[model samples]
Target: MTNAMQLNLTTPGSNLTSYIATANSIPMLTAEEEHALAVDLQENGNLDAARRLILPHLRFVIHVARGYAGYGLQQADLIQEGNIGLMKAVKRFDPSVGVRLVSFAVHWIRAEMHEFILRNWRIVKVATTKAQRKLFFNLRKSKTRLGWFSHEQVQTVANELGVKPETVLEMESRLSGRDVGFDGYQDDDDDSFAYAPAAYLQDVSEEPARVLEAADWSAHNEERLTQAISTLDERSQDILASRWLSEEKTTLHELADKYGISAERIRQLEKAAMQKLRSALMD
Candidate 1:
């Protein structure tokens, strides 16, 4: 069997025979060696000792990272991130606390994996806030079956997590839905895996009556605007042009300078012009 296949056969994260055999052929550390190395790294910041302590834990990080495979990140990359977290935990470890390095590092490992998963969960993240993060991780487990979470099951989870039922339901809906391809290739048939946004999302164009109504309303508004513009004095029209219709609309100060008036006077004129336009449009 290949080395990779052989590696896969062993329990993940615990036995690093493949890595050990490949990297140094060193035996796994005893509890004494492990503690001593952790203490050395923790106290003196010995990077080499830290590397030795963390190398064996690489397999463990891979094991935890594996659980997040559904996120679709490369396993190697996830393991790399988890290894970084493990190294950080080792650096900050308090050996006097009487906890094994593994126990302390597990949080760091999972934290890294969680970050990887969150970042890679979707092209656009499905989770944003802290509660959403919790929901994102727990909602799948919250499911009692493959299809949907029943109301009671949702309530139970909501109570356990101390979140509102509506929040739980919204998250559940998001989880149940999936990302789909926007469009298929040219050769795609009816059975092809395309999900055009036009097909699934609300199509405003589909309602011809609404479309016609919108068009008519827009045309009517334009007519009213033209009529209003016709009614303005030549000076007012010119001021409106430079002030409102230009590529870079003139500021009140600029308009005041041009019209030889205070900025506040310019603002009043602009407001009056807008009010007339509104009245004309309403009519």
Candidate 2:
């Protein structure tokens, strides 16, 4: 905490070349040194030992993150996510596992980067299922041509990926689609608005009947909550209000001092109060 790490993996101002240069400058750890640091952290909780172990392997995270550059996401963001995965792997690493930390950490690093890609690659997500996710990453690399896949090529991809040809075509269609605004262009004069999704797409939420139904449902729930709160005793009511309803919740210790009881007693009372509220709402 005294000072920040000097080995800059990705700073805001640094470009890809600068990041690569900084990463390349860091030295990789030998097997003996890595084992000693891992043992130091595992046995004695030495953070400095952990840092030394982490610093050398940051270049590896950068290397892995580079493989994801075609996704159109920021290079810095990918590396940052990969860095998180590396830290997680380091924390769980066992020195006795008879493998180097980098070997174990690669999976963790890519897993984090994959999550980041799935989250940000498209506005509506190109892949939802497990198989689709695998295909999404591999499909680009599996391509043999620059344009659309031919019928035979489609079948080949389906065979290799263990997915249906239809599924592959559907995913490819989705990948090729671009995100359009729900509302028309920012400066709309009639022509632009006519082409916008909002102009033609059926908005179920905006229907008069749907709006009234939603309002009625919300009001009924509010009434039920009020009735539920009324069922509790005054002390229980105060605890629930201070702990749940108030902007700044009162902690168990704070409530215990106020009620002249132990924190454990407050917790038990709070639990009982919640059960009572649940029962009241059900009725």
Candidate 3:
């Protein structure tokens, strides 16, 4: 396929799933059919024949894009870059090269995707990161050993390298660094890399399942408590409410006065109500 034959088979604003579906709908090309198409395009400059050749292999671009999913960029974007590579492959597909279009297209596909990833990766790591990387390389070359530099050594290195001591320390810190996942947790299913603040721009904490479980447990306990309170007699319920559930708890003497009984009698009633509630809950 020539430049004239590079059709935008993928419609604008199509998502990854729909894009994959559309690519899959195009029938694949056989060796013989591919050879004929190449010859037709080369000899007669047949754009229709070129479209047929290119459209069918869009799925192949997606396949290559899948290999780069670990980079955490948009799959659709990677595939789109790979499509450019595919078009270039189709354009340069020499039948005399004696290889199939797919066999030849692999290089072009990976090159495009890699270039895209590196470009965006630099956007994440352009200014300070780039400088730190350069500093890291230079310092590593100048160092004599693989150990941490002493304070005196750090000053010596800094003065020698014509940079501030803090810059030297910063690069040293970076040398001991590791790149984190762009979206923090590696276990996230959907893409959350779209909104990267300073915290998650590199990586952040994992999922908080324990907090959720605690909340659920609290709600469950509240429900069971309501059910248990429903089983108490009115007097026992009033004693439990006044002595246990009120904002200001009632003393045993106060509860006794309210129930027209001795303090020891109110205590017995309160203890019995607690037992009944506990039994209901345990059931």
Candidate 1, poorest ten consecutive residues by summed lDDT: 181-190
Taken over the whole model, the C-alpha lDDT of each candidate is 0.72, 0.80, 0.77
Worst 10 residues of 2 by lDDT: 182-191
* Native-referenced Cα lDDT, model 1: 0.72
TM-score of each: 0.37, 0.42, 0.42
lDDT tens digits, residues 166-228, model 1?
Answer: 998888877777765454432313255555677767877759999899999999878878899
How many clashes in each candidate? 1, 0, 1
Tens-digit per-residue lDDT, 1-283, candidate 2: 1225343443423576776676677788899999999999999989878778877787888889879877767778888888888877888899998999999999989978886776575832787666677888778666535367889988988998888999889888887787654433344132453355656768788899999999999999999999889978999999999999999999999999998999999999999999998888887
Measure candidate 2: CA RMSD.
Answer: 17.9
Candidate 3 Cα lDDT to native:
0.77
Residue runs of model 3 more than 4 Å from their true location after superposition: 1-8, 124-283
Model 1 Cα RMSD, 1 decimal: 15.1
Total colliding residue pairs, candidate 1: 1
Q: Give the TM-score of candidate 2.
A: 0.42
What clash pairs does model 2 have?
A: none
Give the candidate number with the greatest lDDT: 2
